[model samples]
Target chain A: MSDNQSSGPLVWLGTVLATCITLYLFQGILWLVVPILLSIILYYVTEPLVYRLTHHGWSRESAAGLVMGGLVLLLLAITAVTLPRFASKVTTWNEQKIISNYVQHGADFVESTLRTVEKYVPFIDEYMMSKARDNANWDEQLAKWAADNSSHTIMGLLHWIPSLLLIPYLTYFILVDGSQFKRFLVRAIPNAYFEKSLLLLHRIDDQVRRYFQGLMALTVIDAACLGIGLKLMGISGAFVLGLVIAVLSWIPYVGSIVGCLLVVLVAATDYASQTWMTYGAVALFLGVRLLDDFVFMPMTIGRSLQIHPVVTVLMIFVGGAVSGISGLLLVMPVLGVMMVLGQILGQLATNDRLTARYQFRKALLRARAQKGLEA
Target chain B: MLFSLGKKKNPRLAQLKGVSLFNDLKLSQLRIVNSLLHERNYLESELIFDQGDEGQALYIVASGKVRTHRDNQPEDKFVEFGPGDFFGELALLEDAPRSTSARAVEDTVLLALFRTEFLALLELHSSIGSMISYALARDLSRKLRKAIVSNENPTNL
Candidate 1:
């Protein structure tokens, strides 16, 4: 392989190892960083509004305060209306024999699908009912496991609370002192790289801002479409389903799958005809996913970001592994910043600037030559 | 335009400390700016300044927003100015006529610094002159880059 091909894998492996080591070593600091990360993401999304407000004669503080207040109000509205309904539905689903129906049907589906495939492929037929037996007893084991692990989980949650608190506090300071923060960063950088750093910061900020803001708009659109469709179908818990799907959509591919599975489960358990409701739920999910992937996403983020689906999936997977759900939520923006860094690195490694300059110069020469030839 | 900065604390002026332009300046210099700022209030639909008028003060959005637009047309292209954002700087800094008229988009309060007072501060403390120039240049570059992206025409940049 050429030097570039060989170095690519080596560099990536190094990065993976380095990331793992850092996370392992500084687990405590990671908590504090999470909120700051979230806040920065929020800042990126809200900065344009701030700029607009500032342009119109509102002070930055007042604009930020208004935007933050508006955001808090929005969150409160969602909590007040949606939370109780969501909890009630979850509780009912657990209590009303729905869980047993789901597990039985799920196991049946798995067995049937495996058997059909095993007829051709034979070796994979090792998937037996023994796995279902093991899972049937899973709840009994789970209670014991929870009894043993509850303390650790609680401790971890407690550990995370402080970090969560720190994040919002950090965010407030970041917002209040954002200008000074920028100046401090700029001055800290040597003058030679100041312009490039500023440009990089602006690009990263813009990409992140657009991704988050566009996603927020898309979530509303998705939820509205899904909720309306479900309501039209007279499906119970359509609003909850819609809200769940909208939030899940942020997690990329697997998130959507989970949302679809949940909707299907609800439809299957709640309605009389499993077949029709299954079909309806599947069609609804597929239709919305199609519309989003084909139409809305393209018009909004895909066009601006130009990220490929394969890359998007892989990034989401890596992000999931690294920081769990939060990582998945943030992966796209992080990838955007990384991609920008990658391009710069690629340029440096290949010394591609001369080639770019030459190409442009060649175009100019060709235009001049064509003009002379015409004359 | 001159207003005294007494021992009484002002929240709006205190917030000015966070802005980059005033970040490096001494507290005393900020006190000077506070003294120079005049509190101006306007009703809805009131014109703060008109296009082609010499901008006499850099207006900071104190409590409400203002709308900026060019000479009369169908729709006013509003760049909503709110708290902590300073405008009329283009005219104030360049000594040019206002590029667009600033009208109170709502019932608004503004902190205004007269051009003469601003000039006098720069005259007294020349360091601010360079700082303001640097800040403007930086801001203009950012705006230009943003315009390039939004307009989808890099050649314009």
Candidate 2:
């Protein structure tokens, strides 16, 4: 028991070292991570349906197939309905004259607003004027950056398209053979910790599933709220804008701010003459943010991740630094998994039965040693 | 995409039926239990588990024979268990150290039902769970009664 107790910390340290090495190796093949992560998300999203089908006597394979088939059909229907409208939107957006007019008018409005501020506060005119010049230069730089990155972005998407096609195939295998895979993993555990390890795995699995489900629910609600608000305010392509914002909103607090700024910019450009409409867009965003914080978030995501606010903020920054957007999206879920593992390890350290077993073995070994000495 | 050649019936289901712990279960309930079983093969004299090791699963002999003995006991002081017999049933309820070590007496096959999997099944199907729990309690009661009787009259056996 004493020997086993002493080795516990050593085992934990070894595990942490192994994990760090694994992650470093994994970063080398990071391109493969996105599809695998997406497949995992897809698996959780479709798992309940598969389980329900199995409960009703369908084979696991058949149920997985049925779900995947339904998903493909849904994708086809969405594409058939939306492709032509999307193409037209793209063509309209490509008309440089309309875009240049919007940008010129937007810059003029900002300059005028700064002049009005300078009139009221004369002493800060120099500082305000410099800021206004910086803002104008910022806009030009942003446009130049977008123009430069457009081809690179398109090429990235093209590369991703083939890998994205692998998600369903990966998800299908996961759904059908997941249990066997789990059993295979369980078999690797030492007999002493086998049941405890299995329980820990199940808990982690449940937490991850809930986290993904909550995220999906949150995305849909956010998009719907944004879409309805923008449409009622007479904005064109409200649904599309809402969808883009919703996807971006996966980056947590930063995403929401970015999304709000995007909507306001679009409102300023497209409906500049009606200044009240810009205010309306701002009001609409605040209302949605309030709804998200008070209602949608608590009900959908709750405190399942159980991360501290400070740690979550730090994680977001670190993730952004490490792997950019994908890392930002994944950080919270990864931390949640880590927390679960940490909690399990804590439990194992204090497990009475396991400790008692160790004591028993220790006593047996001691008895044998004493008997040998007597001989 | 690995396919079995045919609808191979799990032989362990038949062996499970003979165990008193599962005697009250309906065929459909038995089938559900069967789905949770994992089969393992052992060569002659191979250790199934060691005395004082933590137990996580109950095992039923699907074929051949097994020997159970305490580490402190003489080698000949062992119990031979054959097909349809089960051991370590207490593990299904709680994690506990094995009281006796078990080994295959001959090339053998055994079916193991892990506690976690069993608990999951119970959570999903409460009615079956209650029935199995009741049967398990009754079986334990019977075994306790037999042990008490044997202890009271050592010469009877």
**Regions of candidate 1 where Cα sits further than 4 Å from its true position:** A1-30, A80-172, A303-308, A318-333, A341-375, B1-157
Candidate 2's docking class is incorrect
lDDT of 2 by residue, B51-140 (tens): 776677788888989998888778897778898778777888877677788888987888788887778777666667778788777867
lDDT by residue (tens digit), candidate 1, A94-176: 45544556544444444454455667776663556446545666644543454455455545766776566554445555665
Interface RMSD of 2: 6.3
Model 2, span A90-175: residue lDDT tens: 45553553454445545645655566667898888677587767765766665555545555564677688777888888999899
Local distance difference test scores for all models: 0.63, 0.72
Using alpha carbons, what is the TM-score of model 1? 0.54
Alpha-carbon error at A192 in model 1, in Å? 1.7
What's the DockQ for every one of the candidates? 0.02, 0.15
Query: RMSD to native for every prediction?
Result: 17.3, 6.7
